[model samples]
Target: MIRVNHRSGGVLVLAVTETRLTAAVAPQFKQLVLDQIEAGNTRLVLDLSEVGFIDSTGLGAMVGILKRVGSRGDVAVCGLQPAAAQMFRLTRMDKVFRIYDDADAAVGALEQS
Candidate 1:
């Protein structure tokens, strides 16, 4: 499951409450982002602090979500655990996504621009 909260500074924070992000939830995650994009929000912050694991499909879903935002806004991911961080580095996705140590930092950084 996921929780999306719209905050000040046009930042929509999506918190992954589940322990793992995999094929099972990738589609739902994508759908959630899509729904928001269609509602006209692109500035997004994904809170992954609670997430314990992520697979390739989950990674792909994240990429797709970012693409959906396009150049209209930005995407930031925060609270990556050690394993998830390693997966991101291995795939070089760390370079693509703006990563933060916490939700406040992610929202602060993105809200500025």
Candidate 2:
């Protein structure tokens, strides 16, 4: 579901390969993220460059992932497609998550902290 690249400075870049994140895949997505966190990745960058569609469940999964990180670390998102970006804005979740235009930039920001 996601390619977890463990970077330096405790930053993990998660690149989702799926184009659509709906109820069917949201659970799996959430699990994948949780698994990554449990594997010791706290600083995260969720790269949604390939995701073109996302439903409510997908949004929930994203929020769930953020919650999973908790006080231990943090999660950021990057490379949101136009549709996904609009959906996040509509849901006002854009304000809740740190966003970046590129994955490296997100990881850099997370690592710099």
Candidate 3:
């Protein structure tokens, strides 16, 4: 589940409500974002501030989302909890996605793009 907020300049901020993003939830999470993309929301800021843990499956889902958006739009991540941040770093996914300290910064950057 995600809390959706529509910001200016066609930016969509999706705050993940789950504490753990693992195999059990990755599929649904991926689908939800894909659905949003299908609905014309290309610019996205995925707020993972509330997600304390993320597994390989979760990371895969995020990657899938970014690939889905491709060159048509951007997908940035913000407010990563320590564990999630570490995972991103360890996997070097930090380089794959735009990361920000908070939703505002991510949204601003996406809006500018």
**Best model number under lDDT:** 3
Q: Model 2: runs farther than 4 Å from truth?
A: none
Better of 2 and 3 by TM-score: 3
TM-score of each: 0.97, 0.96, 0.99
Give me the runs in candidate 1 sitting further than 4 Å from their true place: none
Each model's lDDT comes to 0.92, 0.92, 0.97
The candidate maximizing TM-score is: 3
Q: Report the C-alpha lDDT of model 3 over 1-113, residue by residue, as the tens digit.
A: 89999999999999999999999999999999999999999999999999999999999999999999999899999999999999999999999999999999999999898
Candidate 3, residue 36: Cα displacement in angstroms equals: 0.3
Pairs in clash, predicted candidate 3: none
Q: Please, what are the lDDT tens digits per residue for candidate 2 over residues 1-113?
A: 88878888879899999999899899999998898889888899999999999999999999999988988998899999999999999999999999999998998899887
